[model samples]
Target chain A: MKIVLSATGPGFEAAVDERFGRCPYFLYIDSETLEIEATDNPGEKASGGAGIVAAQAVADKDVKAVLTGHIGPNAHEVLSKAGIKMFTDVTGKVREAVESFKSGNLKESTGPTVAGHFGKGPRV
Target chain B: MIISIASGKGGTGKTLVATSLALSLSENHRVQLLDCDVEEPNAHIFLKPIFDKRETASIPVPVVDEEKCTHCGECSRVCVYNALAVLKTAVMTFPELCHGCGACAYLCPEKAINEELRGIGVIEIGRSGSVDFVHGVLNVGEAMAPPVIRQVKKHIFSDGISIIDASPGTSCPVIEAVKGSDYCLLVTDPTPFGLNDLALAVEAVRSLQIPCGVIINRSDVNDSQIEAYCDRENIPMLMKIPLDIEIAKLYSRGIPLVLGISEWKDRFIDLFEDICACVKQEAI
Candidate 1:
């Protein structure tokens, strides 16, 4: 089974061994199968329509599933259209999330929970 | 006349230069300061403008009636921004990602989708003694800023000199703020990172075909890489702010350096005059 993991956001960065800081997308692979493909979500990087670029990269990989913390509605629509399954709210390390997926514990996400904004609230 | 102060990287004193220049200019001429950094606005903290008027900034987003939505995914098909999604049980609208382009509402065949205003921010017009200040504060978790920036520009005084404090980076937000200005002051430091990003900002402003100058901050800390770049590119180095610990501490406390050192006021006034001279020469 080919799996795509979104490795940014809270509770997932520590599990992922790779660190390409600025790129919005990341790819994780199955060690035994050696199947590899992934993309960064560019939309989260400093605004603009960078999400479309990120979506095109994911579509090119033709991955089967996405595991990550949060998936916005914009990226969600694109991934769905490409027939890619999305799994959200995967906590702890990247390895653990992948393990949960392999064990059939992970479930598909309904959609983005709190829209597209990232980070905390106002200072005052 | 209009002058835009911009930095290619964040925390590089774009607002500092803008506010000080506006204050110095206000003594002799009417000056309006427009803070176009909607995401993390700090000018209001410094200016403390007594807001005379306030208006909500909004943009149209597609709103769907769940009862009428058939989960057919038609609205999601034509959305370039990916703002609409049709799942198993519901059709969702992501307001943050929505650009308010009205494409989804226009393409909906069921007539269930309607355009509605989404509160993204607020535009405030205020006065601080002689200087007029206008800025926008983007609501928390709001992704859109261009519309709010457009609102800021609407308050620009046509006849008086105006200084726009633009957002950092060479991105779309920076471009939107700096566009249509008579001149642009690209603020940068003498470090390697500053030089690299300054080159990128120069390319951005040059592409817009605008006359630009450089202001090197923390001039005494690093080597002369930025100065060398400006010399090589023939872009004049308009002014320099030395590496002073006192200035840094003042900045941390949300105070302009010129307010502490009176002599610095004359330097900014001269810089503004130089920018005006450059623009006048360009017109010929």
Candidate 2:
């Protein structure tokens, strides 16, 4: 199955071998299986919009699922509208998050944890 | 005429100079004081305007309808700001990143996207003694401020003289506030940090082609690098405030130094007259 994993921490990248540096969002594509790989969410930076950008990256990769901790409303809306299912509030290792998704044990988030604007002010 | 008071670096007495000039000018002419520092606005703390009218500042953000969305990804692709996106099974919208340009909605093949008003800040109109005061307050966590600054500028009356307390820094917010002003007062200190940022501000104002004068605050604290910069640039040195702890204390207590010290009122009065003369000469 083509799956997009949205990891909140560096752990998500630790679980995967390939690193999509500086993109905020990572796209993993399985070469042999021809399936979409997992997507990682590089939590919010001090400058804001990291989560939003990460989610957009996932959308750009055409991911099917987002696995992370506490997806905010802004990110959740974008992912859900893109037909991406979110499995949020899952703690522990990034490998576990991917495992839960593979095992069909990860529960879908009803909605984002928080709503409203999230981003840093203009960088002067 | 509209006069903008700006300092490239924060806490350089930009508001102090602006409010003092406005108060002095209000004695003889109809003066409007506009606080354009949307973030961490402190002019209100000093001016203490009695707000007569208040309005919510809003900007457009994209709203998507799931039923109408086909997940074609067209909306996301058309968004130059990356405010919208399409995943394998769904489409996503990031309101914080949206500039509200309505391009995504206009290009949406399914018409699932629509523009909705999002509260970014508030604008207040009030009276501070005889002067009319207008200011913008960007809500906490809102990334956008130039729009709110634009709204505040629209309320400026052309028939009278106005003083805009611009935000610190030579950035977008400062540009929005200083643009279209008849004159800009670049406030600064005598320190190296002050001179560095002042140079940046000079570049910003010069790019806009707005004639500016420099006001050296805490003039006695450091030597005259700011003065030297103005001399080299041929920008007029309008006035200087001596570094006095008493004055600082007065400011910290929310008192305009000109008001706290009756003897210095004439100094501010002269400063306003000088500004008026400069603007009048520029108009010719």
Candidate 3:
């Protein structure tokens, strides 16, 4: 199974970013093999609906789960509807977050972890 | 003439001025008051119009016909809002994310996309005595306000003066209501935040080439910075409504200032005349 982690860079050693919608990068990792594939977050600069767009991008990758610090309501709805479980309030490096997930240390989010416009730019 | 009352910040007395001006002007001419602040319209509280017509405002959202859809992700790729998503076998549409732009339907290669009407808000039309009253109420949690505001602007009366109470902000909704008006009244307080936002609001109105003036609400509460800014910007200081506890108390009770104070009625009438003069001056 593949899992996604919001990251600050394109590597497992990169720190996990707190924002799910406009995070800098998304690290897709193999659950069993621990191999990683990272891609830049495409919704980083969206004017609005960044969360929904980011969730769609992750869904397209066919990830079974996502680990991030916060998930906005719209993204949470889209991901949950796609049957992709979300573990939120995650911290530390991408590798450590994966280990915590393996040991089931992270709590599954039943709803949005943050309010709308949480990932908005300075102007908004 | 269509005049819009706007403010870059909330609680700057846009509705207060708008309602009173409409009331005072109705005595001598045909006046229509449109509350385009769909998110939280408060003009009804003061005007107390007897609404006889309620119309649901809707926008066209794309609906996909799955039978002919190829699931090629064409529609998803074209949607700037990311409202559409393509799974392996089907397309998922998020109606909330859609802006009713019709781009997806237009770009669909399989001819499976069609448009459907989705209600976003409601429009109430009625009369408070001789003055016509109209307002738009956006459904709760609805982010797109421009569509509803546009619907209210469509009801602008051409024969007589139209007074539009725009939502407080310099964003899309305010722009939708204030644009194309004969003049705009930017009501603001005398404070740093008020001045900052007033500048933004002024820029927005000027960009549309609309003549605008300033109304200093609570004018005595602060310094002369607002007046200085107006002079520098070449914007006329049309009026100054001093900070009055009695006025605030009346507003809290849903009474317009012109009705509660009586003297303000004539002042608002004069304000309207000054606006007409400004409009005529701009024409020459």
**Per-residue alpha-carbon lDDT of candidate 1 for residues B1-284, written as tens digits (9 for 90 to 100):** 88998889777788889988998888999999999999988887777789989999989998898888877777766776756656545576767778888888887788889899988999999998799999998899777788889889998887999999999898878898989998999998887788888899999999988899999888784647787788899998999888889898988887777787789999999998899889999999
- Best-to-worst order by DockQ is 3, 2, 1
What residue pairs are clashing in model 1? Answer: A15-A94, A24-A40, A24-A41, A25-A39, A25-A40
Interface RMSD of 2: 3.2
Residue B80, model 3: Cα distance from true site in angstroms:
2.3
Where does model 3 sit among the CAPRI classes?
acceptable
Query: What TM-score is obtained for chain B in each of the predicted models?
Result: 0.90, 0.93, 0.97
Better of 1 and 2 by TM-score: 2
The pairs that clash in candidate 3 are none
| Model 2, residue A103: C-alpha shift (Å) | 11
Choose the strongest candidate by lDDT: 3
* Candidate 2 chain B: worst-modelled 10 consecutive residues by lDDT: B84-93
- Candidate 2, residues B74-114: lDDT per residue as tens digits? 87666666676666565666677777778888988888888
Q: lDDT of all predictions, in order shown?
A: 0.76, 0.76, 0.91
Where is model 3 more than 4 Å wrong at Cα? A1-3, A30-35, A62-91, A96-124, B221-223
Q: Between the candidate structures 1 and 3, which one is better when assessed by DockQ? A: 3
